[model samples]
Target: MKVFDKYILKSFLEPFLATFFVVLFVLVMQSLWLAFDEIAGKGIDIFFILKFLVYLALMLTPTALPIGILLSSIMALGNLSENYEMAAIKSAGISLKRVIRPLIFLILFISALNFVFLNNIYPWATLKQKNLYLNMKKKKPALALVPGAFNTDIPGYSIKFEEKYGEEDNLLKNVQIADLSQSKGKIKVITAQKGIISTEEGSKYMTLTLENGNYYEEHINKSMQPKDRAKMPASKATFKTYTINIDISSFNDDDKLDDEKIKEHHGMLSIVQLDSISKVNKIKYDEYTKNQADYFFNILEAKKLYKYPDSLIDTKLDSVILNNFTTYNKSIVLNESIQLLKRTIDHNKNQKISFKDKRKLLNLYDHEIYYRISFSLACLVLFFIGAPLGSIIRKGGFGLPMIMAIIIFVIYFFISKLGGNLSEESAISALFGSWLSTLILLPFGILLTRRATQGMGIFNIDSVLDNIQKLFNKTGNKTTNL
Candidate 1:
């Protein structure tokens, strides 16, 4: 039994590693394609790019793990069944249950490890990836420019050039720079016949040296006046040689946001941190709700000022007494009531918005608490599904198993995403929504396992239909006899 368990474990491990890396690689490539526009052409260091990929891979582990498990389990079980090894073992007095026992223990262990990863490693990777992307966005855009296009990435400036030459690509011809740094209504245009763009070593500045250029400046009047009366300021100058320096310190790769600050987000909080923060937030939420309720109640009470006689007035007033009030007093009361009604409506709107925002914040924290546990347990649930499904289907190899795994996992992922959105919006309890995917798949897994144990095929639709037809025939014969 020990030897058999070792053999089975080895088979599972080989496929698990292969599938894990493949899935992770695919996900990372997809993410990189989407981010290529922003990260590429920026002259970023190769080390930085590699670091980003590593962090991204770490962040995607939770997503990749379940798929990897599902596919690998299917392949392992399918291979055993396809080769008739499972039947051979069962023929020798070994039950299918015993054969699967070792694998089940391994899956449970993986699930627990997934839990720890979710709590610790996942959050750290999420924080790093988020900060890295933000830092890249903050990088100066001048470094991302392409030839022949108007690059407006830089604030208050638009740069364009006709051609770029030389091994270092420092040489430029027909350069045009528009400087609108001063005001919206003013612009300074500089045109150069030929130029060279370069950055000083160990400096935070970039310089453009032009051999021959013409500078034109224009200022539009800010006053509201007739077009003829609006004064326009214009200036022009010609230079044999000129140089312009721009502060490019923002492009420095060393500048990074503090890790602690980035980790303050809810997604970047560990289980322990989330628990502590959720408790504090819950207390604050309760207090705010109670205080707001009381405040609004006070407002409702104060609204009674619009009514005459106040406490002295009976709930059921006589028509004569009510009609006894003067028209002037009635008009004054109506005006005040309208004004108070408007204020109440506005206050209610703001209160509703405030409460919803607070609830969403609390829900997010609550959701993560359950999200960690659900994703951890998803490993076991998916394995139960894949292993039995593989046995029932009686197919092995990457081809069929990969397809089935993707289809099943996609359904699970979509359901989880839907539940997450619902839970985040407080439409459903966090526990129910977070566990929804697992709950839905659990019964299917049991059914598949039962069928496999009973030596039944995965699908018997024809058998079900035949039984239904026989039942109908028997009912018809009974009616005829009656």
Candidate 2:
């Protein structure tokens, strides 16, 4: 390798490694903070927590890589330019392109590595992280319950509360519980003004004590008469104190922690898996839509209506046809038609919702495939942008370069998120949404590179002013001649 190439490589590598780890650490810590509630007080082992962090860092590597590249590229080139090394190289007939050639190849390799992480390591880490987090939550189910939302992490109960406050965070206020253990022909509900949760060490049961509560139960029997069922046989009672022991043995099983039962999320799929699943789902969706259309058509007897001759289907023929039928027959026919129309309307409404949900799911899969490709290329794209902007700005270190890198990255991040959201809603095609940020930034990068190479500022303000002055001069001359 040439001495200059080695120098450039060393300069870029130092900042790249420093910035990459810094960005990765920040991202991992941010994720950990967001999930602190789920992890804290769950009795998770320290080693288990470390493993989760490793998985989290692995999962977030692709995300942090591009930002790291952008910031470091800016800083590296900015330092060279600020130190007059860029000018010296330019004076010595070394073009900006030649100076960054080694770095360009390096960035390309990093982009490929980023793709590998996105395509393989990301999915594995996502699966492991999700399963581990689920197991942690299940380890102590009481800690999983958050106020104001239905908590179904427990086996046979749905618990909700307006408030949970106490030194141990076990006391609840305005608690409601739905006992789904009796899944056969019986329903029980309990509501309380206050409640307390207690779990003993090495015990299989958690005791819930409710104060000033109402208990309601509804019973249904297959042998009961229609009239008896219509009456809705039920029981109700009020109690100052009520106690229920919930069996939590199933959730306390440590062996299940390593089990990978939940692996269907799009994030947990590779590009090949996503493409295969998306194709299959699209075919199923099309078939479902076609079947629904055919079913509704048959239910509405549309074929029979269309089978009549055009002459007999006219508005005048409608009156004649009704006149031929007796009034009683006419009323029965009209009532049946109205009911069918109502049924068709209701069916269409439901089908619309079903189709929307299916399409959204397909969009998610499609977006993931395209997003992986686009995100991997972001290292290359952002490098072009950051390196050029750094050269033009002619500043080094974490001062101006850091600010510029952050602003550019923020814009890129916002566009990516917005595009993904729109894609998920079916407002835009997944392919377009996934590449939207790249498409938007590529031109800016090109423009910056061109300007920096030509020794021009980001905007040619002097040229604009000169053009305006010339225009004014022409206009004044024309006015004087007139």
Candidate 3:
């Protein structure tokens, strides 16, 4: 019995790992094949290109593992059954449940691994992949153009060449530029007979060695009645051997603003940071509320005091009271207006402060940070579902399993993405969006696992079809309605 348990466990472990690698390979190979041209044209290094792909595979693993595990498990068990290994065990008086103890443990251990990757490692991979992609674009932007292809990089700047030379090293032949500088209002086409790209220390500049070229430009040029600038005249320029320097610094990836840095800015924020922001928000809200209360109370008190009549008062003593009352009332009015203004201004400031209308903005940041983590963790969910699905599928080969895996993965991917959008739009809570995929698949996983382990029929497709036929049956009982 001990030997049998060890043998089956070893079998599962060996093939599960094998299947996992195979699936991971297929997904990544497909991606690389699709993106190969882009990578090569961009002058991307073999090492970095492979590294980028590795992280991509890591990001994808959680999605692939479960299906591999499922199909492999089914094949492993079915083969054993066909060979009468189960019968041999039954004759030895071992119950089916006891035989599966090792598998159960295996499931628990895999689940734990899934959780760790999802929570930590997976998020790190996501961050790295994004950063790497940004860097890759920066390092080799010339990849965007193919030789003799029209390239549009800079806005209002378009270029075409007869040929490209030597691995983004340089270019040769006819070059054309559309100069809208004079007719900046309208496009002016400028064609040059020749041009050369030159590197200037820290920057890349395209220097045009123009032999003969014509520049067309148009614009409103003149000090005009400020309102009549619309009626201004147009202008154009044609030059030979002219030099124009584009601030391609912005075009370079290095100098461009990074969106990831902004997102992860507060992502690494400590609990202390969160608390501080929350505390500041609380203080502003409280101050606004207090000022509002004071304004209303001042109005109430002013009305009450002013309503006291002159006829009810003694002249000598009441005159002092009356004078003091008038002064105080004016002071109160002034104070109220100032406070109201302060509150209004503060409200406007806070309106844009992002704590009011965007109560979920901070929460959204939190959500975004956790999105990759949840996906990584999805590896575990998929595993549970995949393993059981394979057992029930009972097809002992890769074809059926691969198709089923794709279908399940597609459903999982679509729903989760939809949920993520809903949460970001604040249509649904962030936590809910992140967890919705897990919640949806968990029950199906459990159900499938139990059915597979217990040897239950997977579906009632035949019965369901039969029911459809019966619903439209022409044959009917002739007995009177009872």
Candidate 2 stretches with Cα past 4 Å from truth are 141-255, 310-315, 318-321, 326-328, 478-482
**By descending TM-score, how would the candidates be arranged?**
1, 2, 3
Cα lDDT of model 1 by residue, 1-482, tens digit: 59999998887889999999999999999998998888666666677788889989988988899999999999988898999988897798987677778989999998998898889898998898888877776665446667899977766678899889999988988989988676554368999999888887979877889888999886555453557434666789999888988767766655453233566788798989998999999999999999988887897796666766644455665678769899999899999999989998988898898899999999889888998899999999999899888888778899999999999999999999888889989899988889999999999989888888887888799999999999999999999999
Best by lDDT: 2
- What lDDT does candidate 1 reach at residue 79? 91
Compared with the true structure, the alpha-carbon lDDT of candidate 3 equals 0.63
Model 3 Cα shift for residue 375 (angstroms): 6.6
Candidate 2: residue 52 Cα off by (Å): 1.6
| Top-TM-score candidate index | 1
Query: Could you tell me the C-alpha RMSD of candidate 3 in Å?
Result: 9.8
* lDDT digits (tens) for residues 221-266 of candidate 3: 4444557755656455666666667555544544332235423433
Task: List the candidates' TM-scores in order.
Answer: 0.87, 0.76, 0.56
Deviation of model 2 at 365, angstroms: 1.5
Which regions in candidate 3 have their CA more than 4 angstroms from the true location? 26-48, 82-84, 87-91, 135-260, 263-393, 410-454, 459-482
The candidates, ranked best first by lDDT, are: 2, 1, 3
